[model samples]
Target: MTDTTDTAKCPACPGRRHPRQYLCNTCWRSLPSTTRGRLARRDARAFQRLRELHRALAARTPLAIIRVSR
Candidate 1:
């Protein structure tokens, strides 16, 4: 079985991310509240929203400037 406790590197920075999470604490906290709220929602569009976040991050977009569509 896979280790659920393993830590992974954060995509936005060199910080360590907890297992099953997308970003490290610092990086996550840096995101705008609206973005965080949208990401927290568990709905059919959740995956698509996550893709938007990841795409922004991959493009080196600033956390405060990142916006996800509904």
Candidate 2:
């Protein structure tokens, strides 16, 4: 038998849950206001989606982010 419920450690912050979120709370907080504004302005929907995807990645949700146009 094996224990599979262990939470993975964050690459940037050892022994932490990595915030299990987009860019991690620390990184997100550290981002420059200008950068945040830029990200907010360009493709707001895509940016929001990216954040969700990043959260999924942090949780090992087995998902990928891609772009498509029609």
Candidate 3:
């Protein structure tokens, strides 16, 4: 299979590059509205969940704790 995608530079990391990535979907979706501006309410929820997971991992909490509610 062949992929026809253009490489795009990640907005957050100029030195790093991605193929056909726009704001690198993961970062785009994770970005808080306060940082990115005017995000849908649903996207905000997803962003919050991402932050919570990050916080838990940073605090060395077990993955079990993070997955309990999910």
Candidate 4:
């Protein structure tokens, strides 16, 4: 038997996240387009940028105000 209910908690809200996603749909859509673009990029610095996003979220920064370095 396999567990299909494997989901992770959203960092920004109480919503659940799909295994391969960083945030819930609502929270992901709430982010600014620029930030979203930056986060979508997969490069050598991708993990660093993700950490920046997580740090900002941990600080309770608004999604609109969140910025990840290029």
- How many steric overlaps are in each model, in order? 0, 0, 0, 0
List model 2 lDDT by residue over 1-70, tens digit each. Answer: 1322434444334433333333445544544554444434546465565565455546654222221221
Best-to-worst TM-score order: 4, 1, 3, 2
- Model 4 lDDT tens row, 22-45: 788899999999999999898999
Note the Cα lDDT for every prediction shown: 0.86, 0.42, 0.46, 0.88
Clashing pairs for predicted structure model 1, backbone only: none
Clashing pairs in 2: none
Kindly report which residue pairs in candidate 3 clash with one another: none
Which of the predicted structures, 1 or 4, would earn the higher lDDT when compared with the native? 4
**Residue 60 shift from truth in candidate 1, angstroms:** 0.7
| CA lDDT, candidate 2, residue 42 | 41
Q: Which candidate number would show the highest TM-score if scored against the true structure?
A: 4
Give per-model CA RMSD. 2.5, 9.6, 10.9, 2.5
Mark the regions of model 4 whose C-alpha exceeds 4 Å error after superposition: 1-5
Model with the higher lDDT, candidate 2 or 4: 4
Q: Could you give candidate 3's per-residue lDDT for residues 1-70 as a string of tens digits?
A: 2333555655443433356333456555555445334222345365675565456546766443332112
